[model samples]
Target: MSKYWNEEIECMSREDMKKLQSERLVTQVKHVYENVPYYKKLMDEKGVTPDDINGIEDLHKLPFLTKADLREAYPYGLLAKPLSDCVRIQSTSGTTGKRVVAFYTQNDIDIWENCCARAIVAAGGTKDDVCQVCYGYGLFTGGPGLNGGSHKVGCLTLPMSSGNTERQIQFMMDLKSTILCCTPSYAAYIGESLKEMGYKPEDNKLKAGIFGAEPWTEEMRREIEKSLGIKAYDIYGLTETSGPGVSFECEEQTGMHINEDHFIAEIIDPKTGEVLPEGSKGELVFTSITKEAFPLLRYRTRDICVLTREKCSCGRTLVKMSKPMGRSDDMMIIRGVNVFPSQIETVLIEQGYSPNYLIEVDRVNNTDTLDISVEMNAEQFSDTIKDIQKKEAELVAAIKTMLGINPKVHLVSPKSIARSEGKAVRVIDKRKLH
Candidate 1:
């Protein structure tokens, strides 16, 4: 039987779910317009008022909030409640630009954890299960969000932050952790380490894994599943919208079910800013109806995906979002051709290579150069220079066939590329530096 943490809400009829969302959205809009001057200014500039938003249908009329807006707001610009009311704050890694800090009241934390608990339950988690979380702790939402959810599910929680691979494996063996939570890349690395230690796939007790905070291909999913002897599940969330439980995969892994009662999702044309109908692939937009501290209305997520209302076998009426094909911002335009890292990753896995690879793009003599360095699996590594050159040529041809752009492929030593404990850094655009 498929288990659910909140079946009543998850399986609610579409009419009833919309009713609930409409009510919460009305109240939330009023709350923000009254308390958040920054957002109020945005509404004023757009000539939109709290009264203008009658329900979810009016959500499209509101202006979208982007990452640039968050940076402009900085610490207090988007906060809807006073600091005293907020019990916690989580922040983005800020590797790209200024760190975006998100505040959460006690109520906000409770709701966020409940959303994550639903994900855990959907992934076959129970109070009797031991959950091991390897996502980074403090500031980052992945660790704290899943940690709280594990507690809500009454599971024996291991708050192991990322790093110390040997120690992480030891705890998994000693405590018999049944559920593993971490980034898909780190999970892949752990699987490699386990095999290196001579531990078979069945040597551990983990049955399922919740991997997120980064984009991963379906080929990588099967790799992790075979290497770890566990079913891999994807969880989606952002620090701006209360972390890793905004949506999650159920028993049926076709797509992740968005928690509709708490959030309203829309697919919008990235260039035109027009709302697209269901099944149209475009940028994702979200409105947090239940958030109290930092409620974002029509936040632009920049993720390219499609939403489907098709009925699911899990019996959850929540709408499902297809795995994000790629980010609009991450798409690389080289030689007048668009290329995404995911396309390269898919080809790599299909050609019997590890998922670890780095892409470098630069402009030399005003001509764009595309170079890719892929980590060769130890089992496939060749000591002979001729053999290794042959391998690189073969991979370059495969990638060219997929991307329609010839790339210079260099096969690096196994594990030579730095592994990411959080989100992997795959692209190096030296053109920006120049």
Candidate 2:
């Protein structure tokens, strides 16, 4: 565990990468066999042992860990280290059952900082810049992870963990923070707050923003950048995969590059659990080959995405995954038609409407009905209410062509919708029983 942290592993060659992963994988399996009862029982049931997982090629033989497995184990059941050795813990919001808590040793914290540092650097962040972390800190993974990474990057880090948009803007002005990190919804909310406070974007002197923890479209990115007058970059990760620095978008803005050396990423079919080749859309699976405190094997992330092996001009050897559209659980089924809220955002933005929209689904007379509410910018509000009604009608027709279903569309004033600081709750499916 003391030997888990490595900072100078950035320039590892392909062969070096294989050797490092192979060595760490075996060592981790042995550690799990000795210290973790859950993994040991799983191995015994499969009639396999640490000796069988000798290298990366033998990964297929090990039992895959999933959300269900974590749930069955509950809290502290998968720790391969002693409680005295563990320093920190982070849990997923679960929302369905007991939270999935991940234990971390000091070594785990150091490696997380290294990964976050890579993400910051990829987004053109430098030591000269001041980092303002806006993601919520305790229990959630985004804030503290980026805070540590920004500190390690030799920058003046502001641990302003989310909320209080007005105060966040004030600190941004007073401290002159150049780098901002938070969820996309928060960024958009802060943008609206800035406008409400009559603050000019040019006055804050922010240069770049690293946004993650929720899925967002490029249209939303453009809106955030335009509102804040800064370059907005995407950082992708989950608590199951070491949080915010698992993948990151470079200056090219093409896609997020997965840090393949620390964690091996694969896209597999959600239903069949069969690995799909590069460029095929599937669920993202991660194998924490280098983790010590909680090294998850073939962990199903349930994120639908595609990967590309083609080398990018950024010079990073990591593989790139497309921005996730939606989670498999988050997918909507309406009258035998599959729909994603992202598709609605795409249509709204393409038609020159604000990206802020909400979907409401209800069952009446045994038929599901969907209603969408979109906020109309002040620029679109002119003359009278009739004009707004006419525009709303046009948008309703536009959505019909897009979604192939006529969804009741309503237009509301700008800033009238509920602002989300972290994750946005867009859909209200009354038909789905809790």
Best by TM-score: 1
TM-score of 2: 0.92
For model 2 the local lDDT of residue 406 reads: 80
TM-score of 1: 0.97
Please, what are the lDDT tens digits per residue for candidate 2 over residues 201-299? 786789889999887889989988988989999998888767788888877788887777778887888888887877999999888866778878788
Task: Please give the CA lDDT of all the candidate structures.
Answer: 0.93, 0.82
The candidate 1 region of ten consecutive residues with least summed lDDT is 325-334
Lowest-sum lDDT 10-residue window in model 2 = 1-10
Q: Write the per-residue lDDT of candidate 1 for residues 355-374, one digit (tens) a residue.
A: 99999999899888999999
Identify the leading candidate in terms of lDDT: 1
The true-versus-predicted C-alpha distance at residue 353 of model 2, in Å, is 2.3
